[model samples]
Target: MTPDTATPSLPPTPPSRRAEFRFDGDAREYFRIWIVNLFLSVVTLGIYSAWAKVRKKRYFAGNTWVAGANFDYHGNPVSILKGRAIAVATFIVYSVVDNFFPKVGYALLLALVFAAPWLVVRTLQFNAANTSHRNVRFHFHGRYPEALAAIAPLIVWPLIGIAVGWNMSSLPASGTEFFILSMPFIAFAAVYPRVVGALKLFHVRHAAFGEARFALDLPMGDFYRIYIAAAVGAFGLLIVGMVPIALMASLSPLPGLMVAWQAVYLGVAAVFLAYTRSHVANLVFNQARMQGGVRFVSTLTTSRLAKIYFGNLLAIAVSFGLLVPWAVIRTARYRASCLALESDGEMDGVLAGVSENVGAAGDEMGELFDVDVSL
Candidate 1:
């Protein structure tokens, strides 16, 4: 009793090899926060989405951690607002010009539309540059060259379509004629994303990084496969449902019941599509690697994805659609949980950190600011 020499107990060590994911709390809690915020946002129209975006960024940043380091948002929220404002202003100005100076306006709109890819790339870079980690930051240099390369084909594609439309009048109206006329454009559009993504990855890889080299792998085949699968699955659903609907309609007492059934069928189909898309994205991202040959591995299975999709749907249904906020929270957590490191190790948790300046009201709408850094 004179000297209690019992060794002090230590906290349990997290698994050395654990899935890479970031989220500390249950999905339901986040869902609740999302709901309350969403309601306030809807009541105020779109102003709330901005505030909501800030809150969401904070929540996700605060909850996510990478490689034992928390991620932070160093970017200014005002920058996002500014960018959005510019985009809106540009759109309005373009509209007015097109309306007042028909030919000139058309040319200007065409030019702007052709430059759409560059605009998107710049926006992404700006957003990425705003994010930092451990006070150190990542920057996104504009990939103008790649953007221009991608845009040229996009601009030309419309001309091809117009030509086809003009010539169609002379061709016999047959199924084969339609397919022949459209197949090339369809194929081009289908393959365009992969081509553009590969170019973008190449540019991003060469971009500057702080103390680390940036690199990205372009798994074109896998990327295209996932998209094709989604498109095909959606088409398959539609085709499969038609038979059942036709049979049901023949036997149903009320004609209107077919319409209701169609609605239900479409709703279910949409949920299926969402679940499949998420699953495919998780799988693809997990398999893709960064510069250091560090491959990502996702723990999300088809069943788990289905559960998440249905869970969100149930939440929305139960709350008379008021639970959308909560559902989004759960959705994010589910996705985060599914994302993990593929390497062998016991997993503990993923961490994300975000530094933000809240206004006097502690609300995102009240002149909110943030700086994000991810590890």
Candidate 2:
């Protein structure tokens, strides 16, 4: 061979690289899926929805590439159908009981409340167990007690707090007193962040990518600070944001004050939702770690998130929610852009072993309960 010692034309790859999340899914591609889903769902009287869901999830998961690899969904639509059938049956039973046997229906409703924890656990177990990355499955090890505790703030304590707040507040004689009396309701709203944070922490801690488990170790004080700041900031900013609406309401005899007030309420709700979402992502992503040297980083800001969130909502509303696929894709792409995975080595090299196949019962149950504990 000739003595050719010149450097190669192409540069060598970096020794190590952080696994950045990049979603390749586009609204156009998902719109096809969405349109088909809608057509089949309507034509088949919603029987094809099970398969539609599978297709949609598969498309999203398949397109969300991280470090040049994508995820896969192995859920069977038949199983999903079975679960949906059960859910429909349950709902029908509840309705029938409520119509024909009011007392039994009331008892059933109360029983469902107690059953919420079990429902949560089943859904978590189903969802985490089915989702896989690089051929390694994830698992959720959360028990019923843990599941119940995760959502206690929202479901269990609100009623108690309401009664306590009412008893503590004296009868109001003026608007100022009414506002003061409403402080307890404001406090109730404040509990949302804590509940959201706790649920996220619990879910993240229990999630395992193969055998590499995740750990979240932020201080409790920091958790409170995030939520309190968001709650205060949300309401405070809402008050300030209402200035323009107030101007409009006062400017004309257009009967705009009621509309302005409604906008204010929605704006306040959005602010709280946006702030809570932002803090939650920051807290979970910035503090989490896998069993190996793998860690997470997220930089999705509240302002950016709020813009995207509202835009998606508006798009869906304008399109009569036929654009839901686009909305989903938009969210996935933006959120993916905000996430990065830092590992000691190659992403898949950290996997301990393959997880065994699990049934779809829990997955369907999770779907039934509308549990959004996805990572």
Report the CA-based lDDT of candidate 2 relative to the real structure: 0.75
Q: Lowest-lDDT window of 10 residues in candidate 1?
A: 365-374
Summed backbone clashes in each candidate are: 30, 0
Worst 10 residues of 2 by lDDT: 157-166
Error of 2 at 329 (Å): 1.8
Distance (Å) between predicted and true CA of 125, model 2? 2.1
- lDDT at 309, model 1: 68
As a TM-score, model 1 comes out at: 0.67
lDDT of each: 0.57, 0.75
lDDT of 1 by residue, 103-157 (tens): 5665665666565555545544554554554454555554657655644555565
**158-224: candidate 2 lDDT, tens digit per residue:** 4544444445545556667666556657765657656667777788888788888889876556667
Error of 1 at 171 (Å): 12
Candidate 1 RMSD to the correct structure: 10.0
